[model samples]
Target: MAQRLPSAAVLVLHGGRETGAVPPPPGPLNLPGVRMLPFVRAVRRAAGAPDGDVLVRRVRYAHRGWNGGRADPLHDAVTALDALREEAGDVPVVLLGHSMGARAALRAAGHPLVRGVVGLAPWCPPGDPVTQLAGRDVVLLHGNRDRTTSPQATQSLTARARRAGARTCMVTVRGGDHAMIRRAPAWHRLTAGLVAGLLGTRSLPGPVDEALRLPPTAEATLGTLDLDRLGARPHGGPAPAGRR
Candidate 1:
């Protein structure tokens, strides 16, 4: 029987530490990678691929760290994107990444098949490249009280990405912390909506759409992506949009 391919793909990436450790084969262990499993499950359930197609996959890293300039996760993510083309046949892909994973996704967003990226508590440091994000849609969700990753860094990256010509915005999770255990469902829902929307399974979320409509570096609060009735929404706004 011939293999089935979904119309789109989402590469889910988990967080890692700043230091290097040659990784063993990717499997469940450690807090960073393990913490991302829930979000992955949410994406699988909501990614909207028909007939149980594989719409989402996790990126397996060569090392658990950014490894400074080596960027093992970034390399791994690029390899995955290449392999995905072989598996899915040129389908548009959205990257759903957290912390260090988000950092790698943004760095690897230059891949030809990448149409969008959703960064969860991204760890984009000063001087990280923004040039690659041009023409791609970018969404970053950061918890205001996250001590592990700076929410301000995410906002900074969003601004830089916008200036680089990517449609980009950062949504602050009001009471959310680095682990996202606070208001977890809201984060999962918003991330999933952003992923599916970017894949064209549904229309773009409201805030993201609004941000896209604005000129580069334009500042504005987007309501459409968070257009749901979830109580955890910023200011208790409406629930999310783009449900499957």
Candidate 2:
């Protein structure tokens, strides 16, 4: 029998200082530690996203230049998203972004395919403004002790998003840092709860409950090639099958 696709699609945007550049390190050393995959996986599981139905697409913006002056990464992200939507055909999509990526995701919320957006430690871009997010379900998540982006900045952005007429929710991870959700269990729980709510799942009583409900053995199978190992090779070039 053919596999059934998920009803919802997710586009994950990774945060970075440089536009259209490689994503920065995620964990302590700042490596690309599944930036938003874990959260996406958790949400999918909680919401019981059908196999093959739920697709996770990651978009990395190109680095414009040293001055950070260039066409908005959001525009580039939106274009990529448009292609994904065309391929999926009628599936509702959730846009998730971290740091600078969050800002880009917000800017792209007006896209016809987007149903909602989740912004983690989002960074506000100069002149981009939050008005573009009006009428969308926007969730702003941040760590209270985040030194990199600062909670104040997130609050300011959230307020602006709300003013723009977006249905907004702000979640502040207590005693958390820039990478708090990745480090502490408490922060992770908070982040998971927020994501679950956005995905419209019944809230798990706690992190333990959430863990217990996850599939005992689940693995992510890449299409035919492992993009990570292949790096910048052309998409259709000859490549090893199923090996990253």
C-alpha lDDT of all candidate models, in order: 0.78, 0.57
Give the per-residue Cα lDDT of candidate 1 at 13.
88
Q: Which is the leading candidate under lDDT?
A: 1
The regions of model 1 sitting more than 4 angstroms off are 24-26, 220-244
Q: Worst lDDT window (10 residues) for model 2?
A: 218-227
The all-Cα superposition gives candidate 2 an RMSD in Å to the true structure of: 14.2
Residue 116 in candidate 1, Cα distance off native in Å: 0.3
Candidate 2 is scored at a TM of 0.68
For model 1 the local lDDT of residue 133 reads 98
lDDT of 2 at 175: 63
Please provide TM-scores, in order, for all candidate models, with all chains considered together: 0.87, 0.68
Tens digit of lDDT per residue, candidate 2, span 43-79? 5654455455467667755542112655456766787
Off by over 4 Å in 2: 1-5, 18-30, 64-67, 125-127, 181-183, 201-244
